[model samples]
Target: MEVIISNYPEELTFPQEYIDNVKAAAEKVGELYDVANGEVSVTLTNNEYIHTLNKQYRGIDRPTDVLSFALNESEEPEIEGEPEVDVLGDLVISVERAEEQAADFGHSVRREMAFLTVHGMLHLLGYDHMEEADRIEMEEEQRYVMEQLGISRDDAKEKKAPKAEPQQPEADKKAKHKSGFIAVIGRPNVGKSTLVNTLIGQKIAIMSDKPQTTRNRIMCVLTEPDAQIVFLDTPGIHKPKHKLGEYMVKAAEGTLKEVDAILFVVDATQKLGPGEMYILERLQATKRPVILVVNKIDLIEREKALPIIAHYTSKYSFAGVVPISAREKMNLDGLLDEVKSYLPEGPQYYPEDMITDQPERLIVAELVREKALHLTRDEIPHAIAVDVDEMTTRPNDDVYIRATIYVERDSQKGIIIGAKGSMLREIGALARTDIQNLLGSRVFLDLWVKVRKDWRDRDGILRNFGFGDER
Candidate 1:
């Protein structure tokens, strides 16, 4: 295939390795379709450049990783006597979007670029993903092409995003870089973890309808062009019912003074209750600015959210009030704009590839716990705690994880294990799917149920579980 390259994003320095990977991917696609003699054009861009194209051509204002324009959409005879040209249409890849996605997926920019190139080439080859069958086929094709390139998800290493390091001066870089921390806090089940996951474009904090799902101070980072926001997903702030609850409340409250700003999220579906009032009172105690995030606005009428936003604004002098549906990703840009205003210009605190500070084992444990919370009964969820006993990689690059589910009672254990270990299998299956996504590898999850007998109230157990530092 004769691959033609267009101007790249000036801000990104494309390495020869990445360019070779892109070409290899396109050639692989062309060879499979017997289009080895055909011609194709590839254009590299950034989010700002692609946003205009997306808005103009596809009517989408947001930046996407890749956009394809297939030439064979229609056929028309030329008025002049001219020979037909063997050409596939344009393929535009946004470097910024690709970098963000690469970081989110725990892969290198080179691998992500190759994957996007393959995806766009398939589109030009008249393959689509508008339907389920087509999507599966396209995905299979993408997987095959990536495997041929030897940069599949499992093989991707931790590499920095493609950048213009030599071209850009230090003074310009200093002024452009912005990085800081922003703590997310609110009442239980207010979609704080969901908001963190949504903003980060991946799940670092586990989500559950049950209160106090996030028991730790999870640091989820969002890295954009010249900006990085560290989000501290704290445990929900509520009246303590047990030592665990006290630990959660303290962890949430302790973060107020240590961060750049606060995101005090509230559910739009419910009225201002005592729980919200408690959070509001706590916010008043903090000197840091708080951005009132009225989340879950999709559950009610758009107009109904106005009062909820107004009510919270009246309750306290929030730095900014952004009514957003974290689950639906509504008005999140406004939320980030408000957040970025609070962050000071500084050097990037974390590596571009690092999304969360939490280790693999902890994340795996949380994923398992999240699945248990979703699968079990209401009473069993609060009592359920997951501990990963062992985590090791097999010779074939697959992961082997043995974890135990600690519950307060033997009956709860029976409920989790189910008849003939059906429930255990179900939990492992569900958790394995998420763990696989999180790890980017096949996971073999082994689950066991154990009776810890009111571990939540016991400080020894709580300490063992990494929650004994409660004040």
Candidate 2:
């Protein structure tokens, strides 16, 4: 089998080993199907571009890690002349989605990419999972091909084992260490980010009082002497007002499948509404432990918080209920203890020094947006998004960064710019301080406000701004 690979979004870089893995998986698929020879194409891209394709072809309108366009299927137009060789369809894989899934599944991205490639190849050979028998057959074939290629789930686990440093004592190695992922989810303005930051003991996820302040699923690592918890701070779930909101809801819901535990955060002061009820209904379907966290207890009396906890407890069988103030960092230790008790014994997923899995560029962009959310009023915060266009460091000078702040309307643009560009300057200055602290260097930030009219509703514009399906 001949596998042709192309990297889309030109900016992404993949190692030679990744390309080799895909080729090997494709060849294994061909061998399994007894094909004399075949051809396949793999395109590597980000979530936004693949999400567009998924919506266009599959009509699901969400970003998936891998999509198969099989030529053997009737979806392809036929030509009159016979072909000299069999041509399998094209496979489009999202590198970003692969990374996210790899981390969630506790494996290497190479393994994830290889698995996706084999799955796509099987699909190209007319394998599907629409029915039980077909699903079993396809899964069996996928496992057989992956095992032949030395890329089974166990292989991935072995590949992901952490390397020992200067070495710990035998006693330390014998000690049981727990590790697992916990997802923090709730409706908008429920203090989810604040709770995650409190648990991680760092400012990894950007925070603001504005609704939907967090647009992406931010992962933060908390490594302790006995346990390591990877906390996924997802965007607050809300009703879909635009394409972005729909993506956020999907991103939050997607975490339910991959996490070992779920933290259902809710504002203690607010009455139990449809949003919390909606989340409760979803949580009922998952077998994993769900911990009901009634946040903002500092604002409400103990008497008030009791009913809130009782209300949620009556609805579902939560593993535990803890009322605390994420802002005040109250009773967080209890919450952490509860979380740790549920985690099974496992190896550390990330290095201790690492605070978050997000790239520096994404952190900088979020910082910029955090400032915008705090400074703007009304609907401006929801209409705004920041993209880091450039970030470079000089040999003997400050690091320079150019970022664009996108809004949905001309009037909102004027609000962001302010009179004589005062608001823009303020946003830049505030954002620069955080950027400088984050990079540990002096920084120069250039702020530009551009109007991308109703970008939250347009798929193409959302992709350009980096608000892919992952967000």
Candidate 3:
């Protein structure tokens, strides 16, 4: 069956790995059932738009969980023109709702969304939970698929302990010594999050071999002996050309003023030039001790690394010069040791158990952005912005998400839509996979696209897209 999955109103915000899981689940289920071909349309959307859809299609007065529109009434979807691809009708999900449900379910937004995508896909395959037996079967399949994708409901899945001695006797509970900030900074695509993951010893910050995938400052904490290090994983620094660019740069610069120490990450394999120099200029102004972290040493020779390090050292009087690979987890301890030495004494900023300070909904929106950044190529990154319009969870334990994908122009919209909606279908297919991963259970993601006429330049559009206003 030709499964035509599309995100409504906008592209989804999630990771690539999550998207892969959705595709794998589809192939596996289709193969097991001996279904030769099937076509399902999955769209990502926001609350207002999905509310419109719910009102128009289902005659429901309010936005509900996932709404399934089944074209095959009697049996499984039949292969229409070609017996190889069966048309399985359409499934619309609200990303905004999926994010809300994820928070309610106490899981990563990616997990919650993946669950939703799987649930919707099953509906397209004629799997319904209206009956108790069918509901159990569907739920079991969801869990089975999640297991295959290496996703866990356990909290330990994303956590790390600081290397420190056992707790010492303390006179006061709040007087315990522990608190510092490790600000991660770099030009866009320098593997800052990879370094954070290495330090945290877990996948807290989603990593991909893509540039500008991280849009916000994600703080992951590590409590060491007499100190709790808050690792601030900032967005990749780059020239500001759009509203998002300006905001991302502001987020990066803001950390410089607040943090105790800074980890200036650089792609070791690439030549150090203007971008590196521009960042260096910013570091020179910061009073905090700067640790020059030359990442991706795995891609270079020992001899080559020395010269690169030498060249950078000559350019700036960095507090410390360290060479290591973030992805390979090399020389991380030494880097952490340097960071510890620079930390100022203070109480723990967050409880020892807390890893991040970002809200679940914001992360969910970021996850959708991550998915879109990877799926769309070239200048599409600048053209795309995801807005969580409506999110709600039902008493029966299902999530509803609605998201909007905003583009700058009508031509760009056409580019996103693709030939006879094939491109849009591809975007949905890619986004649904991750949405399912984030939501964990059944999620209804409704996606849509709208042209705002150079939103990057318009103040109102920027404000609506969560920019133009001081945070």
Candidate 4:
């Protein structure tokens, strides 16, 4: 299960343990409902953002503690083949509201946040509280999950205070903070970007079905008052075919020695192939603790995943093995718990609000490229790269971005442009929405398509497009 947490507000700060609580809460709900193969996107935002969403979607002017948008209730598009990940739905949580309510109720914010996450996940699973009977059942389910997670009011009694006071803040401040860097390395297209995006609670890295989608080593930060985990989302370690491929492989292996730890993510659905064995062989040389992340467990049953887990465990002595659906956001709290055990006491490496080191230009360009990937077919090829020629703020505060999508063939350019520029328009419409969410402002995206033949093989051209610099 994949539990993606996206913190929208830059200034939102809280204890990192609350994230574990959130994941645990969501996982408990899954356990109760027997939903092992599911995905839940948990978005942490401020009242301002939630208020906007509430007004826009629910016709409510005020911000709510949580809002549920279950895809199960809607008509989700089905892929041609069997789906690898089953998306449960989305949960929009207002952190500001949760904090306020926690104070009002005289409980710790961790408890309040956990309740909200569990309550929200339940709603996404079709549990409702409109009627008295439904309300009773829903509350009972909530209590069961909380109890199962050992986070019930009774379970957390020692952590609670008589009243919210300055002493609690002081105690929190004095608590030892832990911070570390963990590199997320895996075979190509193993949901590394999805996992990182979910962990950071934002989409800083571009994601697609295409192999070698992530060409750069993206540094994503997850911060809390007590802990900060900076993640290095490296390119998939694969055999290189060109300069760009060699650079990608080199860049991925480069981080193994420098990072405090590593997350070796693999697809649970795929057999233990030579590519995976190759990565495991490389891991043999690294003394850094490596946590085996069995991703995409949603595609298979728990019983089936056992043998896959066994296959990898027999090959290498991992620091820990965590089965998760990075797309569904499942059991991530347990994964974090294992990570926390390895973190050393240290200073917070980055500010609480900074989520990623990628500049706006790169993110914007990647967003466009991701859209192009989604819009085009195999005939177009994966030889597309986006360059943001101009990105400036206009007088009215809207971002004016002029970007060009470079393809290897004229036919590919035509495919992206379409017969009447329809495809480009569609891409812009889709990419603009994500750009707005990322930028938090209205954006006027101007996109162009051009042919850059065999740029992947050319060193200067590849470097210009933000490749070969990872070392």
Candidate 5:
């Protein structure tokens, strides 16, 4: 028997041992059925793509653990004369679903993959489980094959235990390093950016009391000696009142498809509301590993936090629950450990020295906007955007930057400029200090204020201000 495996999702990789296990399982099934010569193809894909395949082929609108398309059962032409080998139908397994189930079952993903492969092979070999009796028989066969491969449920659980002695080689230890992308997402002003900064030990994303502070997706990378966790700090998901609001929500939701895990940050002081519920439903649909992070634990008592944890646990089955104060940097190590367990074995996406992928100009613009958010009234922060028009360096001197702060109305513009331009000067001074620190040089700053009426509602102006359609 021959097994061919292909990975459709870049985040997932099938080790040679897994492939060999699948081949052995296929051959064992064939020997049991008196057909030793056979071949099977396995395609590993994510939930979104598998959802489409499920809808198209089985008329099911949701993703499942596995799908088997038996060629023998199809209406295609059958070859004449004696066939050289039996070509069993293809098997499509959702790697995302496999990871989730493995975590839930307290087993390694290799066990889950082998189980699904055996289940699909049974389907290909004319096994039907529509009836109770047939289902038992098929399950029995599955357990027997898995036991033969030394992959029983007990064996998988034993693999999770730590050995008393460290017998692994240095090369094998290095090869076990894991790396993947994680999305930190939540409702507006839930401390998403603060949590990201705390995790990475750097301030790459701007933070403010105002909602929608993050307008674009910012990627911050945390590289440890053994793992690299690329964190995508997304705009908070909220009800859209304008074009900018819509873009923010879309940006947060879009990260669900591409990330290895999601940190669903929430305000521990606030009660669970419809906004959280909306985000939870979306997370459930992705079938990805979601770690519920109740941020700002410093603001609430431990007794009160228990109820909040219970409330969320009752609502959704999160892979892990962590309580931390992003402002105070409390229990963040536990959060990182939870995140690291879900990431797959892979190479680093960015260099170890690099903390963020954001351009310097964009970071500077966001810094200016952060100052504006901090100083202005509640009504002004959401309606404001800063664009760095020019940034240049003089030889052995200082970094010069000119930026325009856009407001939605003339009144708002007046507030930003302030009496005798005091507000604009203050924003520029604070931003200049941060910019200087970032560039490690002296800085000269020029600031201007402009009004782009209803800019958030206008797509053309939004695009011009860097809120493009691409999420």
Candidate 6:
């Protein structure tokens, strides 16, 4: 099937990997049904743009997580076709709400955006979570697909550390509640998401070397006997070039303001650069205590970590200077202890088992994007977006999904599709494997390619592409 993606709202920001995830999920679903060749349209928009859509389409008058427009209104899945491609209709997402929700939930915008896409696609395919039974079924399917795609529920808890001597009575009876926001900030390409994932001990944020890979504030909650820390993995702080860039910067900056502590992650192996300085300046403005985290220490010698710590300590009076490698998971416990010290006593924000607040569609989107980003290199990484148009379960127990991969230009489109459609095929294959792993059942995935002609810079396009909301 062919999936088309377009953006509205003039200046919405999102990672290119999200688009790939949608396409991958669709192909996976298509494979399960043994069907091919369908058409799906997806739009990325901001809150203002989506709000208009919500008001005009559903009469809700307020922006929601997502809205699906299914041209094929029939309740049954379309028959596998010949001359005409199945017209599954359009999926729209709110970039603004995606960003806000990411921060509120403590995960990346990519995950939130992808989750919305998947959720909308499921709705288009007739999956509803209105009742308890329906909700359980849907939740299972969502989690199944997510886990198959390598996304896990954050609710999984870890075994408590054994005490050396005896547990304190007060510490044992009272479940320690550590609830507060910890913002991780740095320039693009610094392992901020990796650090957050390491701290939370789950893959909540999509990790990539691509600069500015994270477009929203992703929340990952970590709980213990006495504490719960909500870690916000934000877009890398960088100079703005487009409206989306401005929004990303705003997301990172805003998170810093609202959080209880800031974990300023930096590449310990590299010398301090302009990007590091830029983030440091912002960190200075925050009244909350800032912990200078020199991540990637595993790449350096043990002696090297000390000098790096000394250099940063000289530059700023950080609340604490911590050196650890997020990739190697070194010194994460120490970092968590420091983060807990900054959190004030507050009511538990989530259940003890809860980890992240993002929905399944967003996580699915991120998984697709991660595959794409890993497969493609350089600037091409930034110009892509994925949209899941439809996700359905047939009577036989197999799942079918339809999605689109969007680009700003025809050349970029050509590159994505590759010669003889080889590149597109490779991306689809890679995505399907992940999706199959996620769903635990056969996935019939259908993929399509189209050019949206600079949709990233166009407001109407952004709104149509699900980049913003109505307000």
lDDT of 2: 0.82
Candidate 5, pairs of clashing residues: none
Badly placed stretches (over 4 Å) of model 4 are: 1-175
Give, for candidate 6, the lowest lDDT window spanning 10 residues: 155-164
Q: What is the lDDT of residue 361 in candidate 5?
A: 92
RMSD of 3: 19.2
lDDT of 6 by residue, 118-214 (tens): 5666666677664335655766666555555554423222112111335458645543345798888888887988877776766667777788788
Evaluated at residue 444, the lDDT of candidate 5 is 91
What does candidate 3's lDDT look like per residue over 1-471, in tens digits?
A: 444555555454544544554465555555555564665666666667778886665444555445567675456654568445555666676766665544444455566556666666677677755433565687777677667656665423212122233554665323234368788999888899888878876455766567766767787888654677988899888888877778888888888888888889998899998998989888888888888999999998888998998899999998999998877888988887788788776533442334566544555566566666566667475667778788777776566777777788888787777788776667666665665555554566676777877877777877776665463
**Total backbone collisions for each predicted model:** 0, 0, 76, 11, 0, 81
TM-score on alpha carbons, each prediction: 0.65, 0.64, 0.59, 0.65, 0.64, 0.62
Off by over 4 Å in 6: 1-175, 379-381, 436-441, 464-466, 469-471
Regions more than 4 Å wrong, model 1: 1-175
Between candidates 3 and 4, which one is better according to lDDT? 4
| Residue 58 of model 1, lDDT score | 48
Pick by lDDT: 1 or 3, better one? 1
Model 1, 1-471: lDDT tens digits are: 888876566555665766777788888888877888877899887888988987776445577778888886365344577655568888998877877766555557887888889888988888876443575687788778777777766545644575543554656533345689898999899999999999998888999888889998898878887588989999999999998988888888888878999998888888899999988887777888889888888899877877777887888998888889898999999999899998887644543445777878989999999988888858576887888999998998888999999999889988899899998899899999989987777889988889999999999998888786843
- For model 2, how does the per-residue alpha-carbon lDDT over 229-252 read when each residue is reduced to its tens digit? 989899998888889988888888
Candidate 4 structure, TM-score to reference: 0.65
The best candidate by lDDT is: 4
**What's the lDDT for all of these models?**
0.82, 0.82, 0.69, 0.83, 0.82, 0.70
The lDDT of model 5 is 0.82
Judging by lDDT, tell me the better candidate of 3 and 6. 6
lDDT at residue 459 of model 3 (Cα atoms): 77
Shift of residue 193 alpha carbon in model 4, Å:
0.7
